[model samples]
Target: MMPNTYTQIYIQLVFATKGRDSQITNLVREEIEKYICGIFNNKGQKVMAIYANPDHVHIFFSYKNLQITISDLVKVVKTESTNFINEKKLCVNHFTWQQGYGAFSYAKSQKERVVNYILNQETHHEKKSFRDEYVEFLNAFEIEFKDEYLFEFYD
Candidate 1:
């Protein structure tokens, strides 16, 4: 006899441009976002929300397929997305994601709030720098990280 297993997991993945270059210009933000969304969808991951600002990206998804680890998922997302941006000529300069990313887990109850937060990245960044906001998220989630180890961001 064969048996089936099932599981559910939710994650909010955040990453930045190499050096936080703010290279995801308004010109190609939507295109890059759609591309990234397609990657997640193609992998059968359900995306709750996705947002790409000039320097960073926020993705909230359900990791229904445990076959892939967070590290593997991030690597693929970054590599494929970078190739996509370059292939599409989305930017005058080459595009690449930073070396590290932030993956935050949340209860199902917090889904809506997280979605709204991702959707409002533009508005939120007007008031708080990405660095401050990133730090706030780390603190909120109680993740231990050193400032130097964090992604490089331009002030």
Candidate 2:
């Protein structure tokens, strides 16, 4: 008999527009969010929550311990989503995601909290910029990041 692999992995991913530009305007944020969700769903991943802001995006998803690496998943998502957005001409100019992304894992118990955070991004951003919020996440998780690697956008 074959052995079974059991695991529950939840990830919250954050990535911004190239050059920290605010390209994901209200005009197309929802569509882009849905498109990204579709990508994860197609891979048999369960998307818990997703939010596409003016300058960045937050996605919480369930990863079922697939053969693919996390970096590969993020790369495909960014590449394919950029291609989809550009092909649809969602923006006046070309659009691209930043080269680097922030991915943090969480316990299943914290899923609801993470989902609420992603869902209430609009209100949260009203109080603080995404840059600060992201930095906070890095700090909270004790992940060391160089200044240059971090996304900076003056909103």
Candidate 3:
């Protein structure tokens, strides 16, 4: 008999636009966020919170699918979202996600905190630039990353 398996994984994904342009304006932010959530839901994942900043996005979700790797999930989300945005002409110019993304895992105990952080991205960015915040997250998570390889920071 096959043994039953169970697992819990919560991840917060961070990614920016190709040129780091403030393209995700207020006019299209809500639609884009909802579309992204749909993508996660369709994959059998539960999205706890998501916010699209002018140039970046943060998504917190409970990963339920073991068949797909995190890297593959991120790639699918980015590609589909880009297509959704461009096809809908949500932005004045074409839209595309950057090459890489930051995926930070969190304990179940920290779910509320992560959700709040993602929901408050607008408020949080008022004081801190996306570059500084991303760098801080990398440092806090003890993830080794080269500055050059990080997202392009125009701010």
The 0-to-1 C-alpha lDDT of every candidate, in the order given, reads 0.90, 0.90, 0.93
Clash pairs (backbone) in predicted model 1: none
Q: In candidate 1, what are the lDDT values of residues 85-119, reduced to their tens digit?
A: 99988887888888999999999899899999999
lDDT of 1 at 3: 92
| Model 1 TM | 0.95
The list of candidate 2 runs beyond 4 A from truth reads none
Best by TM-score: 3
Query: Largest lDDT belongs to which candidate?
Result: 3
lDDT of 2 at 30: 90
The local lDDT score (0 to 100) that residue 15 gets in candidate 3 is: 94
> What is the C-alpha lDDT profile of model 3 across 41-152, one tens digit per residue?
8888899999999899999999998788889988989999999999999999888988999999999999999999989988998899999999999999999999899999
Per residue, candidate 2 scores C-alpha lDDT tens digits across 1-155 of: 99998779999999999888889888898999999989898777889999998889999999984877779889989999999999999977799998888999999889999999999999999999887899999999999988777886665
Error of 3 at 35 (Å): 0.7
| lDDT at residue 85 of model 1 (Cα atoms) | 92
Q: Provide TM-scores for the models.
A: 0.95, 0.95, 0.97
